[model samples]
Target: MRETKEINALLHLIDDPDEEVFSTVSERIVSYGKGIIPNLENLWENTPDETTQERIELLIHSLHYRDLKTNLSDWGKLENPELLQGALLIDRYQYPEVSFNGITQELERMRRNIWLELNNYLTPLEQVNIINGILYNYYKLKGTEVAYTNPDEFFLHKVIESKKGNAISTGILYAALCQLLDINVLPVNIPRQFILGYFDPNYDVLHAGGNPAHKIQFFLDPMTGQVFTHKDVETYFKRISVPPIPTYYKPLTPKRTIQLLTEELSKCFGSQPYKQAELAQLSQLLGD
Candidate 1:
């Protein structure tokens, strides 16, 4: 990071016209990792050529992306990784410099508001109602249909900042809140949909061997905070001609949920080949 002779030489060769020379220099620059970003930024500020500036920008992005891959790999290794933390890592893919402390604080505020209304006597449905009332009604968080045209809809920070997100982002937020409150709500592997299931608290202890679907009292659509009964899910399976398998009803682990999020987010980058490849790699890292 200190402007040593080697770093100065690399910075000077950034304008090399030969592709092989530039690629070698770029690799060496990236080898310095994220700590060299400030030096690159200063170089970008003084550089006159737009092409050279673009090259510097790519180098900076490469550094951030390399760091993201390492962090995500570490996150995947966590036995019980926090869902919010996983989602924030994905958010950082697009916004490398953004601070997520504000996002965490905002979530804490929402959690405290819901906690104030919660009591031991409230039914599971009632608890969900309070969450829905506060999040959807009071906080006015909105959910939109998943559309690949807008990449921001896939980011958690953007979702909180704008109060709008697609099904996946909103579902992550919904499940995250449930996690903070120690509720049993979780995302299920429902085909072609992102939905949460409220598990019976005693099911794990009492009937772990039985069909997992029997453990769910109801399903929730994160898009609108609307509840769905078993009958509704059954009808949906019939309409779609997909058998209602027990596995689909089981809760996805936090790591798997983040993997699915990365997979879905990758779709948004189809037009950008390099970006799509990078996202695909990120998703694969989570899977590994």
Candidate 2:
């Protein structure tokens, strides 16, 4: 930002020894919004003190986080929030400067490739097979169990670039692809697992009153693109000593799915108090 006399004065006081004075100065700098970031960065470069640099870093993070919260709040209000965009917003929490266009363009390329092989005659299972083959075989995307030690796996851009993600990230990627292709795949609220369900196209319009599970043609393990049957899910419920309730089988709305992602991603920040608090706040933005 074009630094005014007041902005220059605030930048000078950022290194103040008094905690109260520094806190007040920091708040005023943040109040200027993200436009003040350039001024902070310039100060950091000329300043020799490590402590002052750290303070400037925190100021920059505060600005980015404030902006992120606003974006996520707006995203949560959408009628049918785009899954990929939601994931990208979560991604910005860690990588504020990362460009999402590359990720979008990459997804578009994959979509075009899948579209070329798709036909109107393909059955639901066949359609899923094509997606599985392209994503797993052609794209070579790998899925691992969720590991909090490796936080990067939860990020959408990192997942795309590394071709590896845990269940949540991979599931989001899968659901996003289906969205682009107009497929009826969605995430289901299976306890302790992130699974996708392939719903019958007419279920929403024709059989909306029945147990939602009855409307699902099959289930998918996002970790491997492997298919599961009703019997399989039923056996899972029995093994876990939980009843297969109607809600468990219902497709999750995009908002809920993104909120789930945010909640899961928050687990990776347990060691960083500021990050954990920030993620908790982000998740609250999507709260019911």
lDDT for predicted candidate 2 compared with the true structure: 0.91
Off by over 4 Å in 1: 203-208
Worst 10 residues of 1 by lDDT: 201-210
**For residues 58-152, could you state the per-residue lDDT of candidate 1 as single tens digits?**
99999999999999899888877889999999999999987889999999999999999999999999999999999999989999998888999
- After superposition, the stretches of candidate 2 with alpha carbons farther than 4 Å from their true spots are 205-208
The TM-score measured for candidate 2 stands at 0.97
CA error at residue 240 for candidate 1, angstroms: 0.9
lDDT of 1: 0.92
Q: Model 1: what TM-score?
A: 0.97
Cα deviation of 73, candidate 2, in Å: 0.6
| TM-score of each model, paired residue for residue | 0.97, 0.97
> What local lDDT score does residue 174 receive in model 2, on the 0 to 100 scale?
96
Q: Give per-residue lDDT, candidate 1, residue 7.
A: 98
